[model samples]
Target: MSDSTDNTTFDSEDLNFDDFQLEDFKYEAPFQPAPEVQRDLSFFKSIPVTVTLEVASKEIALGDLMKAGEGTVIELDKLNGEPLDVKVNGSLMGHAEVVVVNEKYGLRLVDVLDSALTGVGH
Candidate 1:
């Protein structure tokens, strides 16, 4: 029909090549610094410290371990009345002993060992 032909022509005209143009394209970008802002290095130097309590031990055979059970008490080198090793960041710093302060258990520094072993304080 002429009406159907007119409808088809109208639809084709909607998608015609004259209706499209590439001049409408756009490019946008804000100016930014090439190098990012640097943080203060001094903040890294003031890291929180922790004192490590280490019970020095030695490895034994599995057969010996099988012989150890409930009543068996594994002994250590620093026994009662001996000063225990006090470490800082996995390094042997000094020695300490168990003490009670205000009804709470704490470590009392007994001696400051020579730093030659640690290669520090020299």
Candidate 2:
């Protein structure tokens, strides 16, 4: 058997954290501006994108389509001078007007559809 006595000593006043100072260790951060990061957008630009210019569409029956041949005139639903729908990878990206450049058909962008708000490009 041993003597059951509380002989541990502890003084709250002896423990002082106010005498600590960080000046004992010399530390100086080098005067260096952040490195300029050049973003390379060539990868995104190199990606193949399909741009479609929607002119018009017409729903015709299978029997009527078979009956039509060369010299047959089919009418579309879109009116003349109407803005054409521009689609990118099957997504509606914007609207454009048809133009002729160097005897080639070209499209002039008129309105750009917001992909973030409209969730167009997915």
Candidate 3:
């Protein structure tokens, strides 16, 4: 049989922590500024992004669409000479106007999305 005596056991009433000061628990750690990180993101310029020029769109009944042929001209919601929406990776990036360059179709950027709208820098 083990002896029923143990000096390591503690009793809540016997402990007194009120005499210790708060400064006694404090540790002095060295203070230093964190090092800045340097990164090379030049490869971001080489990333490929899909750009699309949206002209106009119209929704018609399935029956009407099936009946229409190449000669059919559907009226769009946008008016003539309106700026086209420029999309990058299926996201609205800016607005542009259509132009003809060397007998090829091209778009001239009229307005670009501000940083506040795209949340670029933020």
Q: Which candidate leads in lDDT?
A: 2
- Candidate 2 lDDT by residue in tens digits, 15-122: 787777867879889899989877665556566889999998899999999999999999998899989899999889898999999999999999999774254222
User: For residues 1-122, what per-residue lDDT tens digits would candidate 3 score against the true structure?
Assistant: 88887679778998777867866687888997789766665566677989999998888899999999988988998888889999888888898998999999999999998633354322
Ranking by lDDT: 2, 3, 1
* Per-structure clash totals for the candidates: 0, 0, 0
Can you tell me which runs of candidate 1 are displaced by over 4 Å?
Answer: 1-45, 116-122
Instruction: State the local distance difference test value for candidate 2.
Output: 0.85
lDDT of 1 by residue, 1-122 (tens): 35555443457546767667757867667887688755555554466667876656657889988999899977766666777889877778898888899998788888877774444222
lDDT for 37 (candidate 2):
71
- lDDT agreement with native, every candidate: 0.72, 0.85, 0.83
For candidate 1, which ten residues in a row score worst on lDDT?
A: 1-10
Question: Which candidate gets the maximum TM-score versus the true structure?
Answer: 3
Better of 2 and 3 by TM-score: 3
**Measured by C-alpha RMSD in angstroms, how accurate is candidate 2?**
8.4
TM-score of the candidate numbered 3? 0.63
By lDDT, is 2 or 3 better?
Answer: 2
TM-score on alpha carbons, each prediction: 0.48, 0.57, 0.63
- Between candidates 1 and 3, name the one with more favorable lDDT: 3
